[model samples]
Target: MDEVLNFIIAAYPDDTLKELIQIKLSLDKTGTVQVSVSNAGPPVHLDRIPRFEPSAPTESNLDGLWYFLAKNFVDHLEFRNLGMDGWQAVLERRLSAASFEPRKADSEGSIDEEIAQFEVRPGRHDDAAELVDLTYDTYGYSYTGPDFYHPSNLSHHLASGEIVSIVATADGVIVGNTSISYPPETPCCAYLGALMVKRSYRRSKAIELMISETVAPAIGNRP
Candidate 1:
């Protein structure tokens, strides 16, 4: 399950933010497993899975590889179009009740231990400069969005609530950050982006904690 889900995030289209990817997993008494992944990217096509090497590997072509890997664990893969909302991919498999395997527990001092070292909180106006510095270190001025590079702009947005920022800190220094913004036309829905973690801190599960623990809860409290 982690293999398929991790590939889904890693292979997410460069044109879209990873924050937009949504995942759901379920298992039934009949020993059927199901996974649903939804995102605002190109439609999923089973034919896109790579059968052989190609001249160039675009994002769409690489998807073929993900689908191919999924085929090993799932009996069926279904793609559903959601109009302007994008698409969803559903994977399903069935097994004898006795064939189900329990998930392996994490070893001591693994991700949980690493995550305990940092703290997540809402970002302040003063954090703009540090956030910009972190972005520069990660994207090297190549991030497509120009707003984040300007500390003044980011500060203004943060102060005005145009952008809701979350930061993960260790020893009072920022190690990771993410933000949410609402589209003018779609105020009911928030777009999550600008997620970045210090190269040295990527293993701390800061990204997962920021989104699942902080961002989602903050969004729920929105008026």
Candidate 2:
């Protein structure tokens, strides 16, 4: 029976496509075996590796570096790649849930002609896709379309809970939109976002109606 041993073999980082070899042993007159030359290997300086350094990340050098010294091998590695697609997906989905954009047809130069109707209620989550398009179309925003809400990352808040929404229909079409984040934390904390109306919806009083209708009800829920 022979002894099984494991050892690390270090090669110059510049070259890789080589095989690792093991050295043999020799015997002396006293029957003692020696393997000094075979045991000697290269010295490792672990501190030189970039990963273990004391440097803060910058916009340029955000990628941290690292090096290692194994039994007989040295390794250099770098880690600095993150994906933005996932983040954009999240942002778009959130925008879909919160953003509201309504368009108006005729600019009557006053609030009376613009506002077709006003409603104080939650934004319709079931029709988010349609609302997203309506909002985008009203604003004249040239996007590929709304951030697609695929089922893979569907959010519950936008689905289960309701958000305060104000809708103004102009000439039988929803022309203005507003929304407020609900389920207030800290008894009075509310978030407002994604408030938009089309250029054609330029009426001073309509803005007041949207602001009042969307915000007033939720705060009333507090006390």
* TM-scores for every predicted model: 0.45, 0.35
- Residue ranges of candidate 1 with Cα displaced over 4 Å: 1-116, 183-186, 220-223
Local distance difference test values of all predictions, in order = 0.73, 0.40
Candidate 2 per-residue lDDT over residues 125-180, each given as its tens digit: 55455456555655555433233132211123446443444566555455566655
Candidate 1 residue-wise lDDT at 206? 82
Candidate 2 accuracy as lDDT: 0.40
Best by lDDT: 1
Predicted structure 2, TM vs. truth: 0.35
Q: Each candidate: RMSD to true structure?
A: 16.2, 23.9
| Model 2 stretches astray by more than 4 angstroms | 1-120, 138-158, 182-188, 217-223
